[model samples]
Target: MELLNQIKENAKKANKKIVLPEGTEERTLKATEILLKEGIAQIILLGNPETVKANAASLGVCIDGATIVDPATDSNRDAYADIMVEIRKKKGLTKEKALDMLNDPLCFGPIMIKAGHADGEVAGAINATGDVLRPAFQFVKTLPGMSVVSGAFLMFLKDKTFGHEGVMVFSDCAVMPETNDKQLAEIAVATAKTAKAIVGMDPKVAMLSFSTKGSAKHDVVDKVANATKIAQEMAPEFKIDGELQLDAAIVEEVAALKAPESPVAGKANVLIFPSLEAGNIGYKLVQRLAGAQAVGPVLQGMAAPINDLSRGCSVSDIVNLVAITATQAAG
Candidate 1:
């Protein structure tokens, strides 16, 4: 079976509840239909009930098994507002302000997850990255022991002759435009966990840089090298190495020549790029040129399973992400 099918199967077994904040969007409604039909998860669509039903009818989509909650009029509004005010009171959030914010599904969705009303959330179809993530950061918060929230992609390639049978985790691809050594270490740890949970792999992390093992001396190389050290200290059980060039990290021949002594050099399945520029560009290049199915920019380090979708994503993308989120929530 394909990776997405495999994920959908696993998600059905998990049977989580995933919330869609962009419930009124056409793509979201369409994906909800498939998710419900397939029993992937119980779904909560956040929008006006009448509007969501009308949209579904207009789109010729059936959201029969999904629950629709109108943030503007739901009975849970008062309880959610109270929760938000309690969580953000230090930020000077008044009950009136919190109630007003709840009118936006983006804010309400994460609140549902935080309140145990939903197992996970998948949004960003029509919302900005910040619009989707800020609520998660504020309400859902980070996982214990994690200080930074990052993003990663599960890169599945058509050819299996490469790293980890052409399955790899590319980290910090959509978040943290730049990272310090500490934040990079945090990203590495979170990504290792993400790979194990979502990709079913024992993570061998490669902290990528332009240089390999002292072959160059720029501060950029030093940053990656330092992050590798910190990640090692933070997660000694993980197989990790760096300041490696991309080739030296994944190609055995190049590893033998350039980083022969490194345990993770050529066997790495988690590629931790030094910055968002490298990660974002690298994933897109592979997706466009290598025929790899880049399945995420999935958010990690949050306490609950909250994912962000590209605004350009198709209905299938939404379906896949909901399954992925269900799997994450299951774990």
Candidate 2:
């Protein structure tokens, strides 16, 4: 709660413009009112103004501060299309096709970010993850020198002694199904940056595996070991150590026995799972069994702070994510 509260405070100070493409969604519209009331951000809702107003009226929510932009009829549509075509010209995109895509609120939102009309975007409620991310990947793309985008979650645990004051960052938990050692290295580096930027933690990252300091032998364990080397080489300043089992990664006693020389072995607050299967299952087990509060699968490594939501997200979920997106934009 303290971490999230700090993030929200940072967001309020950032005063960024966040575009919500699902302007007509009940939860989204409802969240806009809360955001406006708190001054968390300046919001741009993409939809017909009358429909948005009527929907808000029906829902009995006031969205007075939201700038409603109808993507289909906005005067900037032509200019946005021109920017879109220019962005995708190398991919053989045409002006006519770009104009057609701008009709979609999803496409409109990212183009708005790329054109500098908005600071960040949040969507995926009532939409598939692929549909929400496709345009963002095509237009906004990954950050410079980053070939892969990953997801990280801020796991707030019940046991204060376990992590960095009961908080840890879990990565590749929501993206990247299976990655090679190099991609795994990127995930480690990216997750470390996310931990620093969002949680203000000096990330001591542990690359998790079934093995700890060559105690086990397998290709999978070898992959983690190789990735540790790669990630260490990639970011010489960050404390990255790997081929560690989960216990050794976070427990001081276990780390002392298994990886005595590792700088990050005992105090690893950032855990990078070797695969998405392990990451997803691990985070869920901690969230459900250990009763940790999982705050994100916050998408990282994007050029801009675009984010996605589960279709079943609550209004408060929308509000929290917008705050997180704004915080990321501010970072």
Q: Please provide TM-scores, in order, for all candidate models, with all chains considered together.
A: 0.98, 0.97
Question: What's the residue-level lDDT of 162 in candidate 2?
Answer: 74
lDDT assessment of candidate 2: 0.92
Q: Give each model's whole-structure lDDT.
A: 0.91, 0.92
Error of 1 at 149 (Å): 0.9
Give the alpha carbon lDDT tens digit for every residue of 75-144 in model 2: 9989999988888899999999998999999999999999898999999889988898899999999999
Predicted structure with the largest TM-score when compared to the true one: 1
Candidate 1: residue 128 Cα off by (Å): 0.9
Model 1: ten consecutive residues of lowest lDDT: 157-166
Query: Between which residue pairs do clashes occur in model 1?
Result: none
Tens-digit per-residue lDDT, 68-177, candidate 1: 99999989888999999999999999999999999999999999888899999999899999989988899999988888899999898887877667888999999898
